[model samples]
Target: MSRRARWLAGACASTVAVGLLVTGGALATPPQEDSDRSARTEVAVGAYLHYGSPGVERMRELSRWLGGTELRAGHTYLPGDTWSNIEGAPDSLRSWARWRKAKADRLFVLNVPMLEHNEAGVPDGRVAELIGSGAEGEYDHHFRRLAERLVALGVPDTVIVLGWEMNGFNYTHRCRPDPENWQRYWRRIVAAMRSVEGQRFRFDFAPNRGGDAIAWTRCYPGDDVVDIIGMDSYDQPPGSTFREQVTQPYGLQHQVDFAKAHHKLISYPEWGLFRNGDNPDYMRRMLVWIAEHKPLYHSITDYCPHGVWQCTKNPRSARVFRELLSAK
Candidate 1:
């Protein structure tokens, strides 16, 4: 099954107005302090280091190659094994965070599961039912537990990318079929997580780069509930040029404009070569664009077939990456 299909079959289950609202807490800023920079558009670079080799050694290696701490943000996923309440920080996650913290400050982009599974066999109606009834309190319980666990693990202020890519049709959390309930459920999760004492988590309202499924704006939960606006953009669609990718409706530029208008920080939690692999220009263009726009953080997914570290699929892109990062 395809990635989206797997997410759909495992279990079917599962953001914002613009500005005028402040983030939930004052502590919801980037972990590092760059005094010369402004909050609205400060750029902190990082990547998904554990994609290929799952450990701190890989991260350290990447950082050494990049000529700085590998990254400020480390992205990972919470698999759809079970939708039960989290009792404490998972040992692996705790270990990873601890390892990541040793080298540099970490901003974890945790892609959590909204459903029990994302298998193709699951019916939309069943998934809709879960969303409609607030997932039978599972949503609140899960987030509350997650928040508590994070606080206990010493990783407070995590930018929770809750129900990310919901506007995209492929995921189980797609918002089109029942956007109203999706938005409400998001609000509930935010409230529940925030209710956890000492849990200073920021919520990132992220979507794919285009209207491939539904118009992302239609699913906006509201500015008050979201702390950042993120995008998971990849070099897909084969023939489209980089300029077109950013200028297209619901593309990177749209995401940036939306975030700027709302006074929220921007984050590219996931971005890398896809259909157009080894395109050095894409790497150069992306780096320049990121530097110009200055989002809070951006992460390049470094995994086999799509990574710049372990996988040698894109040598030119890797060269550009090293040059740019090393110069910084």
Candidate 2:
């Protein structure tokens, strides 16, 4: 894998006292090119609060700390150890649905891993076989169950980040094993999920930044099946400049252009400090980039190495993140 330090951080516990601190205070705003704020994209701002119910409380605490900057997006992942877990467990679904139902505008992002034992380091031959099975609809019922469960739980309009970072070789659902079969499986899963009644889910096709195992485009299911084009970008490719990150092949710029051409919105499902430790410049640049591009919803994976808030190692970057995002 060309990408590094993109691991999902363990459960986080934020000790930052609510409503008391604003590290750098408000950022100086530039003169508005147009005063019609209504027409502007007040993008849904959020962070990966946690993988469980404590995330809800963490969101509350984070909001207060940011002077009530609306943390409208809540992100989490289904445990991929088993097909049953992928079908949506009651303990987590109930809590997240409760949170989503509390506010009609809150965006719920759920990362759905397409394979069981998703991170077991399965070999390519076995992965290829599994992808072939999935492409032939062997696993359609699992996603259908998940969709029905989400609908029944009252979160019918959740954004489903299916097979996230598929362009990378990090998971069993990866697209590298057989790109053809991978896309077929993606479309099949989407079809199964959509067939469920009372479901309104937006599927996000997110890839890790940079050209990894394969060109992300080769794995694209299609424009019709995908609603949001996203990237799990972190400050990486050690010693690379932010400019290089944007202009590099299959990097941020390419993703934006690709989404625009497909007439779809974009998002950063996962982003934050990486490779470059405590680098505030990368943090500042990423914030500016998000504000400029205006994603549908972008969530910084808020845990050590990638997170600025919960993680203690990157206070400088944390200050930059807090100051920039808080002002918006």
Candidate 3:
């Protein structure tokens, strides 16, 4: 009907293509190799399989169970019962080192308690006293020794979740008693750890989900000393829904916002079913949440009341876990 208009349109399209080719436009299609690499790197997942060398082997087993879901993170806890044990106890380090060295992209996450007898129900008054003392650098040498030990063990590039869940009442390091001293102690520990030679560690300031003893925001030690903002989320409160977990103040959405505001990456070092026992809805919702957010890494606490593979109490949730996380 209009040949002249069609001809003009074709000419303009040809000119644009020529200009793009001449300018090396970024809109040009990317290589298939780069896209494939992206698909492989999107999900970095793991779980708390065990606390020692057994955990190293358990990762492989868990992977097999998940139809070969690759586990890039190895999570563990340094015993809070004694100082020597907390100094990177060799019983587990050697194996974990071997596992980490086997793969260049693998990660090692360690939950480090700030003080001995971390869960021994030390009174708030005493906790305040110890936290104040730590702020004054009285316990600096202990962290320095631990840092040195991590370096010696050949796993210096670790993600240290130091004094995690500080906003909760379960740990003696809880920030309610004295938030200022707690923050100072956190900074001191980070300084001592960073002072170690050959160390490439990342510090995660992780707090329990929800406002437990106090608002976790009050305990932040500043961005200069913190690398990742992490949360240990669990399905809880018997009847609460995941919607509440997202919309509530100081909740999951708040965590993402907080991390964005601070210009830091977010992580879920620990998450799974808790008080709402054997709930598959919680499992499905959590998996969707993590996929949407795309955190640096996440490890579910795979033990009783919160676990799937290790604990047989949540079979429906276990199926959801395998289905979503499976590489197959």
Cα error of candidate 1 at position 180, Å: 0.7
Model 3 Cα displacement at 120 (Å)?
Answer: 0.7
Per-residue lDDT of model 1, residues 141-215, tens digit only: 777888888887777777788888888655566677788888888888888889989987888988888887788
lDDT of 3: 0.79
Q: Which candidate is the best by lDDT?
A: 2
TM-score of each: 0.82, 0.89, 0.87
Off by more than 4 A, model 2? 1-29, 33-41
By lDDT, the candidates rank as 2, 3, 1
Expressed as tens digits, the lDDT of each residue in 1-328 for candidate 3 is: 0001111111001111212211111233322444333434764788887777788888999989988767998888887777777676647878887888899898889989898887678999999999999999998888999899889888899999999999888787788999999999999999999999999999999998888778999999999999999998888852298777876678888899999999998889988888788998778667656655667888988877678998899999998787666656
Task: Please give the lDDT score for candidate 1.
Answer: 0.68
Q: List the residue pairs that clash in candidate 3.
A: none
Q: lDDT of all predictions, in order shown?
A: 0.68, 0.81, 0.79
Output the better candidate (1/2) by lDDT: 2
